[model samples]
Target: MSSLPPVTWLQAFEAAARTLSFTRAGEELAVSQSAISQRIRLLEDRLGQALFIRHPRSLSLTEAGQAWLPSIQEAFERLAQGTAEVFGPEPDAPVLIRATPAVQQYWLAPRLCALHRAHPELALRVVTGVWTQDFVGEDVDIEIRYGQGEWPEMVRESLGEERMTPLCTPAMAERLTTPAELAGTTLLHAAGFAVGWPAWLAAAGVEEIERDTHRLWCDTQVMTLRLAAHGCGVALAHRRLMGSAETLVAPFDIECHTAEGFWLTRPARRSLREPARRVWEWLADQTGEQWP
Candidate 1:
């Protein structure tokens, strides 16, 4: 107590040191990036040493910081081990999860609320991703990815069926009552799938639809579907991604199914804690399949 800095200072240091950036450490700690920076500064002042050299674009640990990091890491690891050994596991700790925005907003939100109602103690920290790199960094416990599930070192299970069809606003659906009517309406296209309006149109016998017709191309599925929802255009989206019970009208009986769809993946070697397992199994259960 005589000379030791506060415990938060050491924690901020450890996280910043491990991440090599205060911003990332703040994200991991669920605090502001500035807070992480401030605590480290206070620690530096208390210890009479500069822990990090702050550059315009990066951070580097000073000699004193490098010398102190090992002890800090060991101490935290020991605390975790001791806590697990004596007090058992902290199952309520937020489960870090990364999901495609489509899944997070439309497919999983209500179900998650249901899950929470059932197990009020279980916690989840859901983040959304649209690109391959959006799911990178931060050791997320579970990922809802949109792909064919070929990621190496990940145990994958497909979610829901692979069915897709054209959806639009109710007003638009009323007007474009038939598949042929889509020729005049804007076709919202989201990239990722090999198939799109071309395949769906062919399948629905929607030929004669002009190539010169208006179309909106987007990089993410969520955005394409969003524009369609707001009456901008028709989105060819997976049936499972349409957010709720009554929203996003399917204007046609014709729909297509492919082998590609959302897949839930986690590291093959990592084990889910009790709470995280509950959320994982709950998601798998939503699709009516058991996750390996």
Candidate 2:
């Protein structure tokens, strides 16, 4: 285990280094000025490095302090990003549909307009992310999860089989005619997808191509699909997600099926509320797919 200074000490040092004033750092952090000084002292003692140069009336960052500030600031940024991804946005309805960010932004968000038009009396909320929500106790009534149709204690219904195909804008589609031709152009992949470029290429019987040729990888389907729609490159995306975007086009007829799928699920013990059941049935109708 590494023996770095505590987070509070690091925070105190970062704030003091930025402002060059302990009093100002304490004011910003809502703490006593003496407390800030004490923390900094403890940190410097631990590291055995003089971070700040103390003068009679003025203060300035030493060589060591200037170098450490950027790393500390970057750590805080990553922490905030992780927090947002885990907790996600707040729900505004008693009946909430929880799913991944890609589905929420591209597929479900557009369908919500039709849902409202069909039944304005029903109010609904959606929570989006790549992480799974706590359906056992949370207020989420319906969850569209991406995986095998098994959730231990939850009731699972088949939304659809997950199919992946290469998609691009109409302008970009004009240049491609066959699966082999794709190697000449930029290939995009969603890093989080169950099936990616490797599986799609293998299914298409494409072999012995350069892997480094202008390729882009995205962490989410929303970004990957949007990049394809904007003509950035050809992205491999789910059939349903690709259908949602009007600007995207599937130039080839080849597609690959993955092991995972979108499953409409809820706790077996807690049946969906009345309003949630209405939306759930409407989703089944909108997709023209059967559900159990």
Q: What is the C-alpha RMSD of each candidate to the true structure, in Å?
A: 9.8, 10.0
Best by lDDT: 1
lDDT of 2 by residue, 131-182 (tens): 5543434556778788887688777777777788889999888988878888
Off by over 4 Å in 1: 1-92, 207-210, 242-245, 289-292
Best by TM-score: 1
Residue 187 lDDT, candidate 1, scale 0-100: 91
Residue 203, model 1: Cα distance from true site in angstroms = 1.3
lDDT string for model 1 (1-292, tens) is 4867788889999999989999999999899999999999899888888999999999999999999999999998888765553433455568878888777777777778888899988777888787877876555778888777888967788775677888888888888767877776799998878778888888888666847468889987788877887889889987755545246878887988777878888766657777778888888777763211
Reference-based lDDT, each prediction:
0.80, 0.77
Per-prediction TM-score: 0.66, 0.62
Over the full model, what C-alpha lDDT does candidate 1 score relative to the true structure?
0.80
